[model samples]
Target: MTESQPHLLFSFGTLLDRQVQTALFGRTVATTPAALAGYATRPLAITDEAVIATSGQDVHLTLERRLGSTVEGAVLRLTDEELAAADAYEVADYARRQVLLTSGETAWAYLDANPLRSAARIVIVGDSIAYGRCDPQGGWTGHLAAAHIAANETQNRVFNLAVPGSTLADVSAQTPALLPPRHPDTLIVAAGINDSAVPLAAPGDGHDGLAHLTGHLDSLAATARRHNARLVVVGPVWLDETRTGDYEGLRFTTDRALALRTALRAWCADHHIDFLDLWEPLRDQPHLLVDGLHPDAAGHKELHRHLDALG
Candidate 1:
C-alpha cells in the first residue's frame, strides 16, 4: 500500500460501534461489508473501565482461528494516525495481525494472541522499593500478586526479584532469568533512584554514569524484545530531604532523583517502552515513607492502585 493511501482494518468487534469509532477517531470511519474466513467469534470479557465506557459493553467479540468458520465484520479505511488511535483503544488482551478476507483483500485484525495462555505472567526486578522494603506486606508488587490471585485463581503469576540497594547494573544482570525456556509475559523495571545517587568522583563521572545507565536500560529492553514481552519502567519517587541525605559516605538528593526520573521517562518514550511516573504522585506524600527512602504500607497501596490501572 502507498504511504498516502488509507490502511484497511477488519473490524469484528467494538470498532463497528459508531460511538466507539467517533471517540477513537473523532469521526465515524468509512467501512465496507467484509467477512474473515477460518475464524470464529468468542466473547472476551473487558476489564478496562475506559474501554467499557467507550464501547458501552463489558464484553466484546474476539476472533479465534477455526477450520470451517467465518466471522462477519466490516473493513474500515483508517489513516496512519487513526490506526494508531485504534491501537491505543485496544487492551493488551488483543494484538493486531494481518489477515486475508473472504473478498480476497488483506486487512489488519485484532486477534486473541494467546487463547490458551490467557493468564499473564509478570516479572518484576528493581531496587528496594520494588522489593516492598518497609511495607509489611512486601509492597505494591505483593499487593498486585494477591489481587491477581484473587481475580484469576492460580492462573496468573507475578515474580518479584527486586534486591535491596540495587543499581541499573544489578538489574541488568538479572535479565538472564527472563530469557528462554520460561520468559515472562511482561517485565517491570523499578530502578534509577539508586543509580542517581552515585556521587561523581571525577570530572567526567556524571557523563559516564548516564551512559552506563543508558546501556543497562538498552540491555533490559533487548532481553524483553527477545521474548516478545512487554517492558515497563517505573520511574523513581521523590525523596524527603529532611529524613534522607548522604548514605555510606555518598550523597542522595532529590535533584538527582528528579533528573534520573526525567532521563528514564525520555528513554522509555524514545524506545516505545511503557513508563510509569511516580515522582509527582508521591512527591508531596511524606507520610507514605517510613524512612524517607522507602514507602510505607499506605504508600505501597497507592502504588498498587496506579499499576493496576494500567490493565
Candidate 2:
C-alpha cells in the first residue's frame, strides 16, 4: 500500500471521535499517539450550527499556552486536500499553527483564536512610498490603520515608521522600535525602490545594491523571528521614467525595479516569509503614479486592497 503524503496534523478534540472523523473525511483515519508540549486544553464554546452538527457537540477542546503543560493528542497523516477539509471542519474560534510535538515531530494544530480578542500591533518601515508621500489618505499603511480604528478595534495599533527617500540601511536603523515591550505582532517592509535608484554617473553593475538590500532583509527576518513576529516584505512599485528620468543626480529605471522585485520574491520564498509584489500589478497603471514616482490616493487604495487580501 502507498503511504499518505506528509501533512501531519495533531488533534486532541472532536477530531478524535470516530464518527466525527468519518463525517469529515469520509473514513476513519489512522493516528499515532503524540503529545504537544507547552500547551493545555480548555473548553471552547462553538456556536456555529454547521460545525456543531458535524462534530455532534457544542463544546470542544482548544489549545492554550501554559508553560510546563502538555496536551495529549494523535498525529494523523493527511493529504493536501484532506488538510483543507480539516481546515474547513475547524470553527472560527480556532486558528491553526505549527507546533513541535514531544515525539520530536512538527505538526499543525488548531488553537484558540485571539486576534479579535487581543489587539495585534503591526509596524511598517520603509521609504516615501510606504510613508504615503503623494496620497492625501496617507498611502496604503494609513488606509490599513484607519480601517482598524473605524472598525472599533481601537487597541489594534498600526505604526507607520517610513521615512521619505530612506533606503534599506535607513529602514534597518528604524527596527530598534521593534524591541522590548513595544514589539509588534507583525512587521511590514515597503522599501527597495530608493535603493534601486542609481546615480546617473555611477560605474559598474548594481550587483552590490541587490546584495546590500537582501542582506538587510536577512537581518530583518532574523529580528522578526527573535521577536516571534510575522515579517512581510512589500516589493517596489513601477516608476514612469518619462517624468522621473534624470530629474535629480539619480536615475530610476524599470529594469532596476524588476531586479529588486525578483530578488525580494526569491529571498522571501527561501526564508518562508510573506512577500507582496507590486510591480506587474501597478506597471500598466501609470495613472496611479501622481509624479511618476509616489502612488496617488486611488493607487494607495488599490495597495490597501491587496494587503488586506493577504490575510
Candidate 3:
C-alpha cells in the first residue's frame, strides 16, 4: 500500500496505561470503550526492565483465546504513525492481528503469531475469501502474497490456487491436479461458506451436512500430510443480514455458519492443524461484510492482518 492509512486499533494490555501510551506516542490519545471477542487476559510477568520501569509494574495482562471470553479494552482511532509507535512498545512476545470488536467495528489488535517456522512455499486453496470476491480494492491474501513477493525474504513464494465457489469437497477431489509440481511447504485452507450452502434444501446424499463436511476436511488434511506440509485452516465468518437472502437458493445461513466452525474446530483437534477460527471474532461484526458475504477492502485488511502474522 502507498503508505498504509490510519486504522482503528484495539489494545488489551499495557497500552491501556496512559503512561505507557503517552511514552510511546508522546501524547495521550482519546479512546472509546471497546472489547475483543474470543480472548481472555491473564497476568504475564514482564522481563524487559525498561517496560517494567516505564509502566511501573512487572505484571501485565497477556491475552489468550477462549471461545466464550472477551477482553475489555479501549479503542483508539490511530494514525499510521501512531500504530508504528505502538508496535515499538510491544515486546517480541506480542504480534499484531485484526479483530472484530463487539462494537460491530473491525480493528487491529496485538495477538500471538507464534509459528513453528516462517513459511517459504505457500499454497492457498479456497473459494472467494481466498479469491477476493471483495471490494474494488481486493482481498487480504492478495496483499499478503504481494508482500512476500516484494520482500524476497525466507525464500518466500506464493501459489494462488483458490477458485470462487470451490469448497472442500471440490478441493478434496481436485487437489492432486490443483497443486503445482512444486509442492507447497505451507498449506492454507479457507473454505466453508460455499460448502455450507444447501442450494434449495438439497443437502443430498443421505448424510448429515456437518458430518459430510468433516469427511471432506479429512481428505484435505490427508493431502497436506502427504506433502509433509504444515497446515492452517481459516474458518467461516459471520454473514450480513442483507446478504443472508441471496443464499436462500444455496441453503446457507448463519446457523450453518456455526456448524461449519464447530466442525472445523473438531477436525483441527483430530488432525493437529493450526486453525484460525474467524467465527468468534467476526460474529458480531456483520457490518464488515461487503456483499453480505465477502469482506470489503478494509475488512480484507482485517483478514490479512491475521494471516500475515503467520510469517
Best by lDDT: 1
RMSD of 2: 6.6
Identify the superior model by lDDT, candidate 1 or candidate 2: 1
The global Cα lDDT (0 to 1) of model 2 is 0.76
Per-candidate TM equals 0.65, 0.65, 0.59
Residue ranges of candidate 1 with Cα displaced over 4 Å: 1-119, 178-182, 200-208, 309-311
Steric overlap count per candidate: 1, 0, 2
Model 1 clash pairs? 132-138
Q: How many backbone clashes does candidate 2 have?
A: 0
- Model 3: how large is the Cα RMSD against the reference? 16.5
Clashing pairs in 3: 198-250, 199-250
1 versus 3: better TM-score goes to: 1
129-215: candidate 1 lDDT, tens digit per residue: 999999889998899878866766544667888898889998998767754544465678998787877563543454534557789
